[model samples]
Target: MAALALFGGIGLSEQKAKETLKNEALSGLLAQAIQQAQDICGSTLDKATGTLLYNAATRLKDQRRLGFLVNYIANKGVSSDLQLNASLDYIKNHPVDPIDTEDFERECGIGVVVTPEQIEEVVEATISKYRNQIMLDRYRFNMGLLMGEARNELKWADGKIIKNEVDLQVLNLLGPKTEADLEKKAKAPKQKAATETTEDKKESEVNGELHIAFERLVGAGSARGGESTNNVPPATATATAPPLMIPSVSLQPTQVSVPNFPADESKGFHTVPITSTIYIEQSDFREVTEKGYKRLTLEQSVGLRHAGYVISVQRVLRNKNGKLVELEATCRKSDMAEKPKAFIHWVSNPLMCELRLYERLFLHKSPEDPSEVPGGFLSDINPNSLVVLGDAMLDVSVRTAKPFDKFQFERVGYFSLDPDSTEQKLVFNRTVMLREDPGKI
Candidate 1:
């Protein structure tokens, strides 16, 4: 009875195992079969079911079952089909061979049976496709070999693989003209040297003309009897003097022909009549030394300020229009008795004096109060107002002058002292708006 029980147990376990296999196989087959049906009907299989079947096939390594399902789909032809029939056919025909048998081998010492002629055709097509693709997606393609891999895996014939030197020679023979065309394109064009421009030619001509004029003037002045004399002869006698036999000196102005520059109307080419009015008046003179005394009228004082100088009005005249005009006015430094001291005083009390004068005339607060005046009148002066007049007049003290120097001209305005100022002359630039409010102009 024990032996009988053992046999029955074994039978039950075997039945269970068989049932499990049957269930698994059926489940897999059903999934694949549905997908096949969908392909045949030219419609998509339910996504979840299709994924289950694909995953099962991969996990089980059941290539035969997968192949069978693919065959069923290829049998049907329709527009909405997945169009995977060719790929399926490839897998069915080229079954994976057993490693031990060595069923797969290279045809001509290479990995595939592709012929040289076929490779050449594929290479040409691939090169053309890649060139076009490069133009279309240059940035993406330049990123790396990933783009190339994608293109190659698409089964688009990439190009001939010249694994050996002999294959390269053969390819060269196939397209000899290509190399020649490349060489022709690589050659650079020859450039001609530039010729002299019109402006340069005109400058040369002007220099030549000036040289000739200078030589002629020198020769005429150096001729005999042209020496200076204190006594002046009568004009008639000088004109009638017997033809002086001055030595004949060969003086010929050299001719220099140069190209003329073309006229350009864009360069300040305009003509307009400019009319100027002048008035002259003779009047009496007067002088006053009293402090706080008005030296000139408001209009005259404004004119003096505009002139950027201290001028003494010696006379006043007016036209029929009731305008007080000044004439024969003499101007000298305000403190001419001590020129150096005056300069120092001007530098030290620049803005204060100007502001005082402005306030007295315009009935307005001192302009310096807002900008220069510190916390109070007793406060320190604005450091920016301190001018180094010593360095400023250095240029004018010497015969040679350097480049212009910009300085805060004390209280007046920012000035760019002109380098053209020599020992005999001095010039200063009044860069800021003379009036406090420019809009008033």
Candidate 2:
């Protein structure tokens, strides 16, 4: 009967590899049906015969029938290739019965025999052909419920066997009640009296501490550290603390060297014990203007003042015959056109020229109001003040001096390094022009 059922579902044609997979799928279902039939009949087939029939069923090209046969063989201990040549010959010779035909026709069938080993081989081949697909089906069934005709087939074959068994055991234990009713009866409400007692104890402790803190805060009022006194009286304000005394540490006297000469001593005359007649270059003379005194920015004034005391030196160069020769010396603007005697007197005093130079190079009109005059405080001076290439002459030694080098130019006030210095020529900016008034620069 199992063989018959398995063969009944085997409806596949062998043509291509894909056809073989279809055969296996059908064989699996056929095998399952045959097994279910055998179980229902309470009859067991020879294991080898069952296997042979399963093998034959799996060789069918129809996947659904092949799958049923494969499952039947699996449950029935049956091999799938049982009587394959015989079945094929039988199928070939005998005309399939219509649904109306009730009896088997035995007259026209060919009886060809097939070995059990052949059945097993066929089953293995069929399974190997569709191993991956079979696995996918198994995984799908396990993950969810089987679907389509397979689901109906399963329902008919097993009749909810697993669910029935589970329900029976549950009913035996739980008296056939609904799950919700069973759960409700199984649970018991816990007595809350012990929990309430614990909560009350905690609440009482919290209340006691809170009451104490509240009473303390209210009673203490503004008093923070110590206990408050109810009888304390407000008193009139009065000076109660004595003055704080800081001890004085006397510092030792510092002997600071004082510059003995007056800061502005243009009028003071010292006799020249030795006078050197120095050459004066006409180009070295600059016309002194009232505006020139105002033009000195703050930085130039400080730079000039810092160049130190000025001294006028002049010399008369002489030929081998002892004849007087004219020499050049730096002079201010007003003295440039004056007679040589007047130039001599002006250059003789250095402090007057130094103060005037400071006024000319450092002072300037305030930027806030151009007309407003301001002293040349170094911090306020425009940085771009000095013009290079102004005429000047110096001794041969001074001519080789580096640019911006500090020098006391005779009769030219004080000079500082200028950018014009080179191997060929040296130039200096008159840092300050001599003047009589200290406030000018």
> Which parts of model 1 are misplaced by more than 4 Å?
1-31, 38-56, 59-120, 125-441
Q: Scored by CA lDDT, what does every candidate get? A: 0.25, 0.27
lDDT of 1 at 42: 49
On residues 1-441, what C-alpha lDDT tens digit does candidate 1 reach at each position?
332232122222333223323444433453455446555644444333333333223222234646443443334321111223233334445665432212212111112233334543443344445554433332223323433443354332322232211222222222111222223333423322222211111111111000000000000000011111122110000000001011111212222111110011111111111011111111111233223222232223211110112333334445578643333333322223111100000110001001101112111144236332222222221112222222121111112324343322222333333554554444444333222322221
**Per-residue lDDT for 54 in model 2?**
37
226 Cα displacement, candidate 2 (Å): 74
Q: Tell me how candidate 2 scores on lDDT.
A: 0.27
Point to the candidate with the largest TM-score: 2
User: Candidate 2 regions off by >4 Å?
Assistant: 1-365, 370-391, 436-441
Clashing pairs in 1: 123-159, 351-411
Residue-wise lDDT of candidate 2 within 241-330, one digit each (tens)?
A: 101111111211111111111111221212211112211222222223222121111111100011111112233334577743332222
